[model samples]
Target: LREERIDTVVNFAAESHNSLAVVDPTRFFRTNVLGTQTLLEASRAAGVTRFHHVSTCEVYGDLALDTDEVFTEESPYRPRTPYNASKAGADHAVRAYFETFGLPITITNCSNNYGPYQFPEKVLPLFTTNALDDEPLPMYASTQNKREWLHVLDHCSAIDLVLRKGVEGETYNVGSGIEATIEEIADLVLELTEKPQSLKTIVPDRPGHDRRYLLDATKIRDELAWEPSHGWRDGLAETVAWYTANRGWWEPLKKRAPVSEETAWR
Candidate 1:
């Protein structure tokens, strides 16, 4: 990317995982922080505008229960994982560059992303494909990890909204506003696959699982008039059916093995 003079730079490269970060903190920082700076530095020198740094809801840490208050653009950074800390650092640096250099940059923090064409390590396909093959689906952590699910199309729409309508030096929170715990999601998968409940396995939980992730997208809605078109239920059904009919697509990828958790993929 540095070799080419690009008009816009979008940084979506990061090894995002809470437990993985705990295992190797340095690698997370190296890619998330150093890579971001390298791209931004090159973009600034090349006169690139409209920088979009993709971020995640893990930066918000655990949200308190009994409150419907979704995170907005003004939420403070309280990332619990090394992965999230690195992303949070990069997010801060983007703001700094825009403020100090007057660069036309936009930042958007999003929630758990799940859909078709996703890597098998992520949950939706991991669980769905495992069930499809009658393999035991593992659930890491307490299975209560609350994640705000968003279809990949919804995320792309939100990013498009930010890229087209968001002002410079601004950040938007893009999410599906539909939250679910890992346990509930596992149940959904089991129900979809017509598998018996005995297939759900509770293994050792991943380190530093965020209790709940929520996003209040009123700002984006009020500004760009964009909202998620796919509800979690509808999206889940479609996702289940997609994996069922497309066994040839995900079967080969099953060599990677099933995992405990990650952002939404269904």
Candidate 2:
């Protein structure tokens, strides 16, 4: 980056697998926390003034299932899983660099992102690929776990906006404000693939699974004038079609981490 005279740095690299994190948390800390600090140090040494850190909404923990409360930029950090904890630590490191080193940095905590080129291990692509192959779609515990859905393109747009026009040392919560349960997602995937709902299999939930995740995207929406262009159903259907047409891309990934009945859904 110094050789190329890069002026902007966007850190999106992390060990983001929740299930894998539980199995091996050291890797998450190494990549998500230490790796972030290493990059921040390098960026400062390289004289890179602008740094954008992409984080996850999981760092806020879970909101009450019955409440309308959503996580905001000011929300207190209460991470539940190893993955979330590592990310929260990384977020702190980013802010520390900005405060102590005077590095111009902006952070974004985005909700669940689904779209093309997603690895099959994630929820949307996992269920989509399973439905395409007529395999059992694993559901963690019950379908009551609610998550705010955001198309990957919308997430990209929000990040771009923050990187270009956002204030330094600030954090933004980016989400679609659209929430859905795991059951609904499974049903939709089945309907789109013309598969039977019987393919949905309830698997043992992982330890410390958050019941609901909702983000208050008002800051990004009102301040940055950023909004999600793709709706839930349309984006999901388009994503299903993309995976069906581009089996070659996900097929190899599936083989690398073959989903089974015991596979934990993230």
Which candidate's lDDT is highest?
A: 2
Q: What are the lDDT scores of the predictions, listed in order?
A: 0.82, 0.92
Q: In angstroms, how far off is 115's CA in candidate 1? A: 0.5
TM-score of 2: 0.97
- In candidate 2, list every pair of residues with a backbone clash: none
| Local accuracy of candidate 2 as per-residue lDDT tens digits, 1-266 | 79989899999999987888877899999999999999999999999989999999999999888998999889999999999999999999999999999999999999999999988888999999999999998998867889999999999999999988899999999999999999999999999999998999998888888999999989988998998999999999999999999988989888885434365443
Q: What is the C-alpha lDDT profile of model 1 across 1-266, one tens digit per residue? A: 44676788888888875656776789999999988888888888888867888988777766876577678778888988788899989988888898898878988888888888887777778788888888888887577767889999999998888888888888888887788988899899999889988888877756666678898888888998989999898899899998889988877776664333442221
TM-scores, all candidates, are 0.91, 0.97
lDDT of 1 at 12: 87
* Model 1 steric clash pairs: 113-264, 114-264, 114-265, 114-266, 115-265, 115-266, 141-205
lDDT of model 2 at position 71: 92
lDDT of 2 at 260: 48
